[model samples]
Target: MPPCQSSQSFALDAIDSLVRCGVLITEENPEAAPVCDFWKKKGSLKWTTTDDPYHSDSDCEEQDLCSYKISQPSRCPDMLFFLCSMLAGHLRTLCWATMALDLMNTPLAEAEFVRQIHSHLWNTANQKKQYYESCSEEAAHTAVRTLIDLGVLLEERQTGGVFLGVSPLFQLSENRQKLHYFITQYLYS
Candidate 1:
């Protein structure tokens, strides 16, 4: 099977198992709504009125699941750049991510870095009412965590202090320029 198809099948099976095991309550379940919404937005799941509730067939024509495929070792930076571009589509996330990148050169403590990003997001949300109203500190934390999970950010603890920096995987000048362009186009424009 194609990689994307296999990924879709695996996701469907996992969701089915979760639902069957009562781990995920679909009906009137507030917690599951976000999970469902995310999958639906990603075109991995669909809701059908006539069929058996949720449909497994995804119509995500623009969804390129193969973007993460690294056919050559030299293409790693390209993959990371693609991932960042995807995240740039979400304004609030782009703000948090780019703010992290901006502060990468500063020798601030980890907690201070997170605090600064949260403050920046909160202030921006206040100024831009139409974009987002739920840019809470928790959201900032989640964005930072996501960057870390994606290997775009790194955290190290030493006797001097806790250091946070962009991962070496994304430290290339070309990648930095592309990321800055994304910030300008998506966040400012």
Candidate 2:
């Protein structure tokens, strides 16, 4: 039987191979245009350039990229957790309003849920004067769709109507606590 490799190790190996092939250029590669562009756009990838001059060129004053260190696996958060946290940050009002509804205990009709989010945003904007006008119904719909895409919310259809509730992923106590923390921190702080 083939050796069983953990997903993390497998992913790291694949990334290393890409890096070797110049497909996933690290900050260290001499030709790092793509990585530099990515850094400029996202500023998410960590990199550092050393002051030491390149051995091949004496006239060019560019710092050496070879010394840059790759980000360690231990320092990286789980992808799903990171995505959820980012989503909560981006949709703070929607996340807060949804959690306030306590969807786990009482699922709401889809329209009612969207209405609640719209109303919450309207009231919040009015109180904070954060916006000249209230958020539109389309924005509320998009937020709901995003939540569904992230598996944070689930949709169900009964004979009477379609209802929305917290997904099984968030129904777990641990996940629920983490999500609650993110939502509250983003919305209140």
Candidate 3:
């Protein structure tokens, strides 16, 4: 599979973690079939069978389930979009991404890398520039360290601060496709 597939899986995994942790729940039916006794009649808490639309169903038992209410219907998509936006911001900050386009496999200088990233953030897409830069310089540094940890980037020996592209997945030709795939996987998977 393409490296982007992995990236997509990573994105999906992150989102799934939120869902699994109960930070977000499906809007349509938070409790399709009561999985706990909280929703049904208890010592002082009395709930009629009519309280649940699924309670009377012959094929299903809705009692003994938690009828938790979830207010946000757009949470899944909204969170996914936010996740992508944040990732795009971080990727744009990683100027070494250009090395992905260099067929010659040239390493980018650290100073040049920062300069290029600044130019991209300061000039391109004026509306988002500020928001993109909201990520602290320290955060960018941490992101770079993460890339290196993930084997996506390589540290140069000649220039201690310089970095080289070690993975082709970041190439311009594959960047968008990878990002799209990542988002799609996160939304569907």
Q: Return the TM-score for candidate 2, rounded to 2 decimals.
A: 0.43
Off by over 4 Å in 2: 1-90, 93-95, 103-105, 132-134, 172-177, 180-189
Candidate 1's TM-score reads 0.43
What TM value does model 3 have? 0.37
TM agreement with the true structure for every prediction: 0.43, 0.43, 0.37
Tens-place lDDT digits, model 2, residues 42-118: 33322332233442222444444442223323435354355545554346655545554453354788998888777
What's the best-to-worst order under TM-score?
A: 1, 2, 3
Q: Relative to the unseen true structure, what is the C-alpha lDDT of residue 66 in candidate 2, on a scale of 0 to 100?
A: 40
Give lDDT tens digits, candidate 1, residues 73-162.
Answer: 342535534654555435555555565565456445778777877777776766776545436667777777766654456788889788
Instruction: List clashing residue pairs in candidate 1.
Output: none
Model 3, 47-156: lDDT tens digits are 22232334322334333433333223453546645664656555554432333233334367655544444444444436543554524555445554655654455667
How much is the lDDT of residue 73 in candidate 1? Answer: 30
Candidates in order have lDDT scores of 0.54, 0.54, 0.43
The clash count of every prediction, one per candidate, is: 0, 0, 5
> Once model 2 is optimally superposed onto the true structure by TM-score, how far is the C-alpha of residue 90 displaced, in angstroms?
5.7
Candidate 1: lDDT of 67?
11
